[model samples]
Target: MADRDSLIADFLSRTAWAGARRAPLAGDASNRRYERLTDPATGRTAVLMDAPPVKGEDVRPFVRIAQFLRGAGLSAPEIFAEDTVYGFLLLEDLGDDLFARVLERRPDLENSLYEAGIDVLAALHAVDPPDLPSYDPALMSELAALAFDKYRSGVVGDANDGIRAEFVARFRQLLEHAATPERPVLIQRDYHAENLLWLPERSGPARVGLLDFQDAMLGHPAYDLVSLLQDARRDVPPAIETAMIDRFVTRTGADRAAFLPAYAVLGAQRNLRILGVFARLGMEHGKPHYVDLIPRVWRLLQHDLDHPALDPVATLLRAALPEPTPDNLQRLKRQ
Candidate 1:
């Protein structure tokens, strides 16, 4: 703790705002932490990102992506100073108007905010993404399998070995069918309402400020779109979701036939992963509120499974995992 405090002090002392007043900022699921620092003399504020390397956190990806987004004329935070050795960054504070917060205060702005987010995705997909890991079928299937391994097993106990194997095979096939897209684009793996900021005064895609993008990867463009529209934490109106889908398809000239199936498959994969993640957070990490969100995630998963292309995988999953009823949710929470 002493070393960390000293490092933060040294990092700030070297900057022009030497004695900034620092206050805690909300953190994400990762090991990283953030503080809002206010320069007393100038009354200007910046965000201090504390990503300690010892906890397997690195700031390089964030730095690289911030530069990339800014260069591309997007609204990623500007880096003012960085101490890579200790993994501390002083960043331009993008302000408190996160899209989620804005929506909570002004429901009327929901349509514009969501549309701006969609436009950001469309603009980002149009560019050639930086070199990153491929979100391939093998990887996607592995991630989705977490649902069975953690949530199903923890909530309903283990399944028969034969059934598990069959489920794995069916799930992998569905992922392969969806992941192999003709035009893969850079996917901000966590592009959702919570990670997006509403910068309405700005024009075009820049009207949306990007956050929490260290996990960006090379994947089908539909992956990020699904992440935004099918958010587990918030209920996006179905009409807005449909309209945005139409807008993206028309704007990008994407084949509706191909894109819709890919969207469904990726949505299923992502929601499945969330089920496992939420379960793990509750059971292993003592964060039980995440368990409350499973039913919602399950509903989203079922919606994706309704797609004809996902029938085989959906059948296997429905047979394997028990319905997420009140009793089942209670069992999961108990874990």
Candidate 2:
């Protein structure tokens, strides 16, 4: 494939591409491949995505959500064209800069970046959305089940499957207690720094461009916030996280009396799910980068659980994790 210089030309000819060449880009969690195309016709560069739907890499939802989001004045990648069945997409190029890259260069920019992210999220949540298939209750249940299947699948040791049972039972209790707001909104499920591209143009309100939004859904608002504040790849400063939350509260004008507890509970719920996923990725998917994040994620999980606002979940994980010991995790990691 490396020697196949004409592959891009052939693909473009097959797709009637106006681009000069195709440059492949790396991906995560999906079998789909991406190539940046420089089309001469219309003098526009677009992204060419090849998703083998047979391999469960459908691109329709991404298309639909992007359309709907753009209608709402958001800067989702615009679709230039598509081949639905074969799973090919021509998308408006959003430049090479990503939010992760922005943060790496300017640590002092976090405050503004986080504020802009939260503001956009608030607008999305304020849409008074139409009914759409959501992952609210579904995700809550699935996360519990995942903890059992992945974490307690005899992978982490003394805990075993029994620990899964305990976690699920407690998770159920937490879900039923917190649940979600009946008023749902389109959730950019993976709206973290990495999925955001910093585009200063058309950047007045939406300072960042959205990516990997095929997983968008009508769901809980806090889920996305948790993803940002407790980012998997970066440690968002505590002050930054607090300021973002405050800005969200102020912009929405939601009752403070109700916001803190629910946010804490959702934060706790989400981190627990991520913990299981981290372990599962290492043991099942053979991915080690996710494994390294386990300790940091564990600390975040405990930090949220320990919050008085989320006393119940905090109590549960504290009981589950116990007095921290090198041996406990070392032995548990074996399971």
Candidate 3:
């Protein structure tokens, strides 16, 4: 810890924010920690990202994607200074107007804020993506299995490995069949309200500030849209979700028939992955609070499964995983 502090001090010392006052910021599920750095004299502020390399966190993907998004006219933070080797970055502080916070304070602005965010996705999808790994069926299927392996297994003594293998094989087939493999768009895997900032002063899609995009990968356009609408952290009103889906389809000229199914599949895949992740975070990582969010995630999963496109896999999931009842939730927390 002392060595890390010295590294942070030295990194800031060489930069324009030398001797800046620092205050810790709330971190996400990842190992990365952030701090707000304020210049004592000028009062200017920048965000300090302290991603320890020892924890297997890398800053290169973030730097690369931030530059790409900014170049594409979106509001990804500007990189002020970086120490790739030590995994520290001085970034533009986009401020406290996160979409979730703004909506909580001013519920009336919900529609406009959500619309702008959807517009950003449309704009991003219109362009050709940079070189990045594909969030392919194989990878996605593997991740979705975490639902059975972690969440289900943790809740109900043990899951049948044989059933898990069968589900994954069938789920992968569904994914492969539904996906438009030829047309891939850059998807910010965690593109939801919590990661979005409402910068109303800026015009068009630029009004939405982007964050937590280091895991961006090439996937179906509907993937990020699912992440946006079926959020686990906060409830996006059903009316708003429907209207935004219409808005995105209109803007992007996507076939409603083809798009809706892909949206459902992606949502199912993402929510299933979250179930496993939340369970693992509580049971193994000692972050039990995430277990409280399981009910919302389970609701979203059920909604996704109700879609006719997921009929084949829905029964399998339902039979395999137990419901997140109050008792089941307690079981997770107790772990």
Best by lDDT: 3
What number of backbone clashes does candidate 3 have, counting pairs of residues 3 or more apart or in separate chains? 0
Q: List where candidate 1 sits over 4 angstroms from the true fold.
A: 159-161
lDDT by residue (32-95, candidate 2, tens digit) is 7888777555666778888876788888888888887787778888887776766778788888
The whole-model C-alpha lDDT of candidate 3 against the native structure comes to 0.93
lDDT of each: 0.87, 0.70, 0.93
The residue pairs in collision within model 3 are none
Decreasing TM-score order of the candidates: 3, 1, 2
| Candidate 3 C-alpha error for residue 154, in Å | 0.5
Q: Write the per-residue lDDT of candidate 1 for residues 102-206, one digit (tens) a residue.
A: 999999998899889888888887887788888888888878888888888877787456776776787788777765878778888899889999887899999
Q: What lDDT would candidate 1 get against the real structure? A: 0.87
Best by TM-score: 3
> What is the RMSD of candidate 3?
1.1
Q: Which portions of model 3 show Cα errors greater than 4 Å?
A: none
